[model samples]
Target: MNSLNSPWAAHFIQTGAGNNQSFEQAGALTLENIKTLFAECDKPYSGLPPSALKKAIYSSDLSQVQPLEKVIEQTNRLIAKNSIMVQHPHCIAHLHTPPLISSVMAEFYIAALNQSMDSWDQASSATFLEQFIVDWLVQTFSLGADADGVFTSGGTQSNLMGLLLARDWFANTHSQHNIQQDGLPEYGHKMRIICSDKSHFTVQKSASLMGLGERAVVCVKTNQQGQMDIDELQQTIEALTAQDLLPIAVVATAGTTDHGAIDDLHGIVTLCRQYGLWSHIDGAYGGALMLSEKHKYRLKGIESADSVSVDFHKLFYQTISCGALLVKDKSNFSSLLYHADYLNREGDELPNLVDKSIATTKRFDALKMFMTLKSVGAQTLGEMYDKLIELSAQVADSVKENDHFELCCEPLLSTVLFRLSSHYQGSLSSGEFNQLHQTLRLQLLTSGDAVIAETKVNGKLYLKFTLLNPCLTLSDFDSLFAKIESHAKLLTNKAL
Candidate 1:
């Protein structure tokens, strides 16, 4: 028999005729495994400890095929022991959320169909549906009829896309410099993207990737709450202009990482207009505020941004890796559009998604959001976010009342930053104080009863509560805080 035509080789091809029976069994088993794992998410740390995982992983044989029942049971057990239980109220770490059941169902379908979004031919109806979703998002931003966007991996990719288009458009608009073709023009080395010091680090990374050094990201001073100081930004722009440096874009962060501070969007956009700079908003965390009737006003000038990036996974309650980059004017995407004979041809009109995005062979992650909105409705999600925000405020109040803790700032969106105040009475230095807070975070993680993020503000360590779980209540937070304070005192006593 020919090697290619042999049953063994053909079964690996993934075509229905070759592997349909095997695929069906595997798919069913995987779904059942997921259900079993998800059922155990009430625990703070559902995963096994490091030592046990290492032992099991070393013993497992990948080369041998196991029975379907055995495989399913083993997979479910491994997942239950290893996965972070986001659904648990005490697991309020990072910007992660327990994905909605409706959206999880959508994810299963998205995976099963395996729709790729690069071109028209690969995902015919899916391509249009993605476009429809993009249109809906653009409308939500009130970005006008000419607005367009593409789904990305997450905030990082979306932010990269935002800056990439801005970089090219700025080059072309200013001096007819074709950034894509010319590599970097004479002054491209001096290209600057200004944003708050509190802005996400992705901006500086994007600058570095774009051949503009990290120094090209000029940091404007932020206020106590972390919003950019417009006066300082103006002064910095003037100083840079005096130095003959070119300003490519102004990246206004809608929600900062550590502080969750929303920069003055209207103020930032106004500056961009004056400086002839493209405005980009990294609304990755706070962008879901648009869904809220009560808080949509917070992002007042987001409509004026040249481009905006928002993540569905963060606050919009979708699963991981669902984000979009929206441009005010669809023509901005032309900078990235490329033509190929077999894929996105020049003459064809079937919505070639590859034209607007940096990625090819993209996942249909947008379907998760689409299904979420269709089933749960936007208002419902907004209310969920509002509830979390409210819960964060209660946590903040609890922190303030406790002498063992110090609130860093008022709760903005859903994140709360605070730190320990060990009454150790050992003439402790500030650096020692910082170390105690770090120890507190580590202790909690090792205990596996709670999960919370830790970040620094102004070179000082602070504990964080990123409350993306709407199901959590003040009682859950009370328990987590008690754990935190008790753990800190225990560490302090150990030091004594």
Candidate 2:
């Protein structure tokens, strides 16, 4: 037998290929196992450490069949042992939530089909489905008739695609497409991108990857609430033009990472139109909130953007790696088109995803969102956001009332920043306040009872809570704080 052909793979496959009775027995056994596992994991929600996983029972040789089987069993045991239970009411760390159950089941079929989405010939209906979804999203956001876009791995990739498209669009119009093939030659002026200071660092990184140095991303000052200051932005643009620099694009953040603060899209859009600069919205975190009838006004001018990036995984209750970029003009995608004699037709009538994206192979991310949308509709998702916003307001009010914690900033979207008030004194130096903030976050994570995020506000570190889950309540934070208090005491004792 070839050493590469391991019997362990055969054994695993054989286990999956089962009779009706075998499935019944397996189902019964799995339920029993899950129940027992949940019981052991229920109390304390989580712990510092459970126990080191049992050592591998297999030898190094690939030909060792029985020992390899034992190793597989041990690995499965460990995977089934612990559950983060993000769906449970207790979880409140990163931006996460209980995904739609239907999408979870659809993923199995998507995986089995293994369709290549680069070309219509490769995927047929799958390719059309992806295009239709992108089209639908454009319509939903009210992007103009010129709107078009492509799916990406996530926000980072989506941001990169936006910058790449803007570069191609600008250069093509300015120099008759010289940069695409000849590269930047006889460049008339240095290019620059304007974005809020609160914008994600990914914007700067994307610029760097696109041959635009990090210095190309100019950070416009934001207001106290983290919203971009329109006046400051206008002044910056004017200053750049005065220096004979080419202003390529203005990136407006729909929901900032730390605070969920949405910049004034209307103001940014007006400025972009007035200056003839490309306008792109990095809405990967908050763009989906457009579904909310109540909170939709927060992102009023998003429909006017030249391009928009949205992440379905963040607030749509979908699995990760589902992100999309929307462009107001489909022709802009032509700038990314490539031809391979073996892969694509010379004049393909059908929409090829690869023509519009930086990636050659794309996942069926639309299926999950499609299943979720069809089953429940967008309005339900909107209601979920409304509920979360209301819950966050309640949490903020509670934080304000509590003498122990201080609300560092008002609730923006679904995140709140607060820190311990116990450390506050009649007069304390900024250095001392910063130390207290660091100590508080360290205490929470080390305790493992609850995990809270932290961020800086006006140079002071403050604990941040991102309320992505609609099901969580203020009572949940009450429970979270009780654990924090206990952990803080333990940490303080150790420090003493």
Candidate 3:
């Protein structure tokens, strides 16, 4: 049989060959299907219960081959329809951001090209483009002339890279021990990483993954504003020294998860320098502020960090799974460097990105940022983030003025933490109060009215509004607050 007559011929994307019309048809059909899906859903979520959603998705038959249209129709019915709408004004539950249109377009090209960033031969242009993006990021953050970076999956991977390098660098410098060639050194058990109590959980997770237990992370108490307490950090370091334990690195958070608090980077770096420790800044959320002329001062000392993690998916409004880990000295990447003779051959003049990355077959995610930067310049993106920050402050002020709500703290970035007031709580017990907040958040979500975040602060439950959408206005939030009030009343009446 002629290969062109086979059933599989039309399914694969082909270029510069016979009968390429299927590619165009498939692209059009898929895009139209997506547009229809978006237009059909009015709410941020379908409000489907978990079991029902699961069963509906699982019912699809993957055993049989289906036409593109049939598969897309099923996806619309079972999957896309029920997914959370991050672009919705009420959908401000997490660090998730609605991707920029430019980045979305770049995603299409990224997937279509299917370039393996590991080797120059597989992705000649892509490899160089990623290097350019990494170089630009290093320069933009003022990571010094000797600094370099590599894109990763997201914050978790980036944070791991930072901690991994810190551990290896410390081992090599202190005892002339090579962690890559050999296992962990004898003092590895005593090595410690210090961060604020409000730091992202990845810091502890990274330590455990690096063979150091969670106990290796000594969390200094945060201040009232949720910033890392500089004095407490110094005290903790001195105490660790007194105990003869080795403190390898200090992980400072630029924007905490719940409170959006940025630690005192300058103070933390100063302490790190005094104590002769490596400094890493986890700027996965607030790192975008470097582009903001108005708020860049918040991350003043980030440039001096021994390593830094920046996620483009958060405040930068890029697509998900886009992040970079930067190091002050390019030599730090030696910890993860390797020469795969078949891929990144030694003495090859061409650059192979996998040497600086933990991932080998990485997507061309750098193109998304590159396209976004080119289409909408950094200043515009910074202004969009600035608008969100301004909106968060407005929401905080409004919450303070409301009689039914209790404001937690002044938002340093775009997250507003608050809870129902005692007046609204009435005679409910401590447990009841916590349950009420939790129930209120769920009721709103399950009803598809809003998607607010719920978190615990000092053992007390609180509602969070991670205001990531710059297009949202005070009126939109006012409407959402009215819905929240109504939901709380309904839940409270039921409990009573």
Candidate 4:
């Protein structure tokens, strides 16, 4: 049982548990198997009911290992049947996008080697590559030579990092205590963050995570265009100051979630500077506009921000969980630094990425962008995004022209907010219309004919077309709108 002489025995042990450096295999078998599995995923969705889908996945037992071929087949079935195919042209929901093929190809190597960005010793070249990518991002934001950044899982983590640093900076400069050493300062409840009402909910959620209660978040009013009203923000700040509350930071949205609204960055930044408050821009959805010469101006004050969150997965056409947090001054990252003797000792000169990120064992996702940039330069990506931004305006006009649909506002970015108007006068109330939109959205989702987004604005439910698919045309949206009308009409008839 313990014989080491046999080549087969050695191979089995090496492949199962030994480090790749000590015992590496070609991995050809698994790669070929996965390729075959991917070939089966042709449909946008599985079309299976919730219960049936659960049964398919949960029925498999983990007590014993199955044949590799059978496992591959099962995985193929899952990929083909159960996945939410973001690549589908009709999947204009959320900030999701069809990933660039080059980025997907880069994931193969990223997964194979399994590099971590936490320590320079572990990731080696990956660490430098990530830093290079971060530098490119800093340059893109025009944050100057002093700018620096770190990649994150996504917007949430980046937002958290931004708030965390801001929190620590507040504790250090405003008070005698250091939060990193002595915990949250006294009167922490008095600390507050200000942002537009349309900014992502992550701002409030992040405050809660940092021990600042949700009440610490102050929602400033936005204009009809969904941008943060600068006048209202100034008044709110003055009122907060009169109350003697600590204004820690002001979070600005480069693009609001529902309306794709871009707040006046210059306006917000001016106020932040005036108040001596940290400026953080949540550009998770609209950050990619920086690539476009035409649209980059939308994110004007983003370069002036102390911290910025950009999700490449959203507009860059990259896979999930690829985002970055950039800082105008590289030294501000010291708030996140806590040298680990065993990992990145004080004596070590090499860069330790963990000092700047919430995650330690991070994937080399920057490779996806690097590969994409190398294959088809940044200008091409910008052009693709410009195409969509232009399309969103056209789609909004289509909705306005259609008597059946009530357009929420002029299209700002790639999102068009609208709702189906009920013809029944006095019979259907605002609440009933809300229910109608909710019902229609669910109906369409269940049918899998199309996947769109929905959000409530001014207490009125509205449908959203978060169009990120560059290849999709106004005709595709027209077809989807037609289906919505047909579906809504059928529902209305049944009710009558």
Tens-digit per-residue lDDT, 1-496, candidate 4:
5454454453343334443332333355556655664566543555676677788778888897875556656675664457777766677778888889998889888986789889998899999999999989998889999999999989999998998888888788887678878889887889999988998889989999999988999999888778998999999999999999988899999888888899989888989899989999999988899999998988888888999999989888888879999998888787777877878787789988999877878999999989999998899999998999899999988998998888889988889998886573136677876887788887777777667789988898889989898998888878888888888888887655
lDDT per residue, candidate 3, 1-496, as tens digits? 9667888888777655667787887788888988887777678888998788888778767898887778877777778888899988889899999999999999999988999989899998998899999999999999899999999999999999999999998998899999999989988999999999999999999999999999999999987678998888999999998999999999999999989999999889988888889999999999999999999998999999999999999988889879999999999898788877798776889888888888988989999999999999999999998899998999999999998899988999999999998876778898899999998998889878889899888988999999888889999989889999999888887877
User: Considering every candidate listed, which one attains the maximal TM-score?
Assistant: 3
- Pairs that collide in candidate 3 are none
Pairs with backbone N, CA or C atoms under 3 Å apart (clashes), candidate 2: 146-328, 146-329, 147-328
Which regions of candidate 3 fall more than 4 Å away from where they truly are? 1-6
CA shift of 272, model 3, Å: 1.0
Error of 3 at 412 (Å): 0.7
**Each candidate: RMSD:** 2.6, 4.1, 1.3, 3.3
CA deviation > 4 Å runs, candidate 2: 1-73, 79-85, 422-436, 493-496
Output the worst ten-in-a-row residue range by lDDT, candidate 2. Answer: 50-59
TM-score of 2: 0.88
lDDT of 2 by residue, 58-121 (tens): 3234575564335444434655544455655545666765677767756765775678778887
User: So what's the TM-score on candidate 1?
Assistant: 0.94
Candidate lDDT values, in order:
0.85, 0.78, 0.90, 0.84
Per-model clash counts, in order, read 3, 3, 0, 1
lDDT of 2 at 342: 57
Cα shift from native, residue 396, model 2 (Å)? 0.3
